[model samples]
Target: SYGMVIGYCRGDHFPNVLYGYVMLAVIGGLYGCIGGGFLGLGLETTESKQPKWAQLLTEMVAGGMLAWGLLIYQLEWFMTPPRSELWAACLGAAIAMIWYMVRNKFDRALRVAIYSMLGAGFGFSFGNFIQGLGQASGLSYNWWNVMEFILGLSGGIAMAYAVATTKWEKTMQPSRTVQNLSIIFIFLILPLVNYFSGFTEEKIRDLAENLSVSDIDSFVLFQHIEAWLSITLFAAIGIAAWWQRASDRLQKWFSFVMLSSLSLCYTLLALIHKGFFHIELSIKNSITLYLPILFLAVWLGTSITQPWLNSSNSAGNKKIWQLVAGMTICIILIALISIYINNPTDRTPQRF
Candidate 1:
């Protein structure tokens, strides 16, 4: 809903349909909230207690039909709606019902999906805000997509840790100081960064659309540097905390710091890159680009290692790390092969 609001408010993509999109989101949210509340109340008041699956099935059907009707009405309001709109609405309703049924059976899947969606939404919005800041700062690189992807990944990890573990609160209880700091870092610090650094929609769109593959490669290098830098910084912190006999809360905070740093650094580098604003790359520009990577590498490490390094069971840790490494190598090899097959000469240094 908020994504729709932001997209509509931009006025570039949906000039004539801004009001319509906003109204659709508003109605959808309201309908979901009110109808859900009423239905929940009805379920609570029922005298004949139905089996949980039966109750869930009933809720899914009701919710799906309600969503379908609401979506169709909204789509019809369009001046010349596509027939696909009806099909899309039907698909959405079916997905919702199926999701509910599946979630009723597997609670963990529902938890993960809900958290993932929340993470994705927050990450996307935050990335947009950061892109705006980058534009305002005269940094012309387009890293908004990367920012969203990394932030979403971080959000998912953090949320999964928070939800999946029953011992999170207990584990962190001894380190109240660290937990409070983590909260501040995640909520207050990050949002402030976005507010201060984000770019406008028009600027972000222009840069993103114009960027080249080489520019992206340079950006990827920056990502690699940032990821390793974050991992190293947090690893050091974790080590120090262990030495000081700090609580597990510090470990959790370390995780957040690692994720947050990677996300933030990407956004900053994307903004600072000149490819978006300049036609030709210069030695000075190259030097400027290499400096951050160098500094971060020196401060952190040259490569990313697992976050659980300080924890025991080093052999088990190696196994998990090996699996991740294998997957990454496979992906890179496949991508390279695909590119080679597509255009052998395209491998030559090409600039936009």
Candidate 2:
């Protein structure tokens, strides 16, 4: 999950320093929290374990301290330095480590295969990012796009490992499927939370000056909706998964696959913006492709738990399949609906 946050926060990837954007905006039940008290989902106050005002003040101070600290640090340490070269070094180390660990599995012939895909992804993302920054005065740079390949490779492998670990190992029980789903989800959920962080509005505003939108109204609407639903879907899936507790393994695995798929989707997003879309935008370019996989693959897989059927009636695992399936479908539909409704998009959109 922490790794996911870093992925979404990659400043070079997405504009607006979306890093801090999520922190201040969305916390659970923010709609109910007022002055410093938690009113919970119902917005009905319960006993204040801590004084409301004190909590509010403390949260404020902490947030301020943290933000200022980061600001100082970036300005002093990272911001003062050249980002491209620095980021490149960092990314290179990561890519090396991933290949180091996994290289044995591949024959020499397969080396180029992994690197090629990674290179293409790297070039596309970095190229766009540099183009955006090219016009900025204080933020001028002459970094190579190939370095972004290292960044992307590092990012991809790190993301993969992050997913693999939580998805594969987080299962209290033995189930690869559940763990994988959970791992991937943690990635998606954090960014979703960040979308509500309130940082986006400013980030978008600042970037919009450099934006090339002949139709500002349309683009503005898209920016809002894309950010909004991105977060909502993450929350829906996360909460629903928790409520279902279908299987930690399934949760991790599904999320891992989803993020992996999103990485690919991101590439598609870049291509679309540059190609036919000609809108100078990158939306959930991968979502339509990913949605069906969720509906059919994980949702259906959870339904047909083989171990449960193979076991005796008294076996506890028997009901596990039923729970997984039922929850998968219920959660998917509910989440899908909730995400679309709360998103920038319209509910019952006449044509999706």
Q: How many clashes in each structure?
A: 9, 30
Give the alpha carbon lDDT tens digit for every residue of 49-159 in model 2: 212445334544555455445444454433212222232232233333223323332121122222222333333333333433332323333333323433344334322
lDDT of 2 at 87: 28
Off by over 4 Å in 2: 1-145, 152-189, 196-199, 215-218, 241-352
In the predicted model 1, the residue pairs found to clash are: 129-198, 130-198, 131-199, 132-198, 132-199, 132-200, 133-197, 133-198, 133-199
**Residue 349's lDDT in candidate 1:** 24
The alpha-carbon lDDT assigned to residue 345 of candidate 1 equals: 33
- Tens-digit lDDT track of model 1 for 119-158: 4333443444444444445655654544444454445443
Q: How does model 2 fare in lDDT? A: 0.35
Query: Whole-model lDDT for model 1 versus the true structure?
Result: 0.40
lDDT of each: 0.40, 0.35
